[model samples]
Target: MRIYAHRGASKDAPENTLKAFCLAFSQHADGIEFDVYQHENGIIVFHDRTLRRRANAEGYLLETPWSTLQTLDIGDGERIPTLNETLGVVPTNKWCNIEIKHLVDVKRWVNDVKAALSQSQIAIEHVLVSSFNHHWLKAITDLWPEVKIGALSASYELDCTASAKALNAYSVNIALDAVDKTFVQTVLSEGFNVYVYTVDEPKDMEMLAQWGVTGIFTNVPELAKRVMAKRASAKDAVSDKS
Candidate 1:
């Protein structure tokens, strides 16, 4: 199973910073997931609508200008990274899962992302767009059919399989707590990939792998690596005995 760094190794470094992303890459995560929001001038990396968690400021991320957002320290002297800057910093080999946080004039943001990616000459296969807003994902898929998209859900009440089909999503990302072997099987039976989020424990990683998940979003990429390695070693030993 692929292990993606949730918010770029958020447990060790400040979430959604260049430093965090570099740490995740160094730790050998298959992909890095980060949240994106459209600013007045450009797109910036952050999870919350308010900047209080990352910075001392008390305003909405969209309300603040890019320049002001750039100045605010997101713990440990790391500043918010723009989408272009993040793309430049991230290695070409590692996959990037950019989750759109809000849905407002996403056409421009989608166009900008596509334009920036086109200019960089990076492989399109390494990027995947995901969002909780079904309409936003639909819009992205409509405009950029080649780019892979994932339907993100925090609850099981929504029919993930139906949503995936409706949005033409390549994968469905759901909360770790809500997923199990049956859920994975159900989604896989429908011909859609299944991935779970924010998995931090080693036991949970093993369980998810056994459940046949395609990927896992984790705050601690190192922990995920260690767990995966252990599982692989154990499987090899069992095969040798057989």
Candidate 2:
């Protein structure tokens, strides 16, 4: 399974900061997942509509100009990074999952992101855009047919197969708590990759791997790597004995 650093090895570094992203890469995560919202000037990396969590400043992000927003120290003097800035710094081989946080301006954000990535010469295959907003995913797929999309869900109210068919999503990201072998089978049966989020426990990672998940978004990529390596070694030993 692919290990994607959730908000860039967020357990060690300030979430959504470039420091976090760089740290994730250093830890050998296959991918990095970061949240994005449209600012007045462009797309910026941040999860909240307000500055309450990461910054000293207070206001809705959309109301604040990019210049003013960039000045605030998210934590440890890490300024909020633009999508372009983050992509530019990250290695081309590493996958980037850009989760769109704003549902209202999803189309605009997708267009801007595509434009920024193209200008930066980053391959589209290296990126997967996702959102909990189904409409946003639909709109994006409609506009850019080739870009891979993932349906984000924290609940099981919607059937995975139906959702994937509806959105034409390459994958589905479900809450870690909601996953099991049956659910994994259901997703895989439909030819869609299943990725679970925010998994930090070693046992849970092992269980998910056994269930045949395609990827995991985690706050601790280093730990995930260690656990996966141990599992691989055990499997190899079993094969040798047989």
Q: Pick the candidate with the highest TM-score.
A: 1
Return the TM-score for each candidate structure: 0.96, 0.95
Off by over 4 Å in 1: 119-121
5-122 per-residue lDDT for model 1 (tens digits): 9999899999999999889989999989999987778777889999887898899888887778878988899999888877876776778899999767767987889877876535
Give one digit per residue, the lDDT tens place, for model 2 in 16-46. 9889988998999998999988776888899
Candidate 1 lDDT for residue 76: 93
Q: What is the lDDT of candidate 1?
A: 0.87
CA lDDT, every model vs. true structure: 0.87, 0.87
lDDT measured at residue 219 in model 1 versus the true structure, 0 to 100: 96
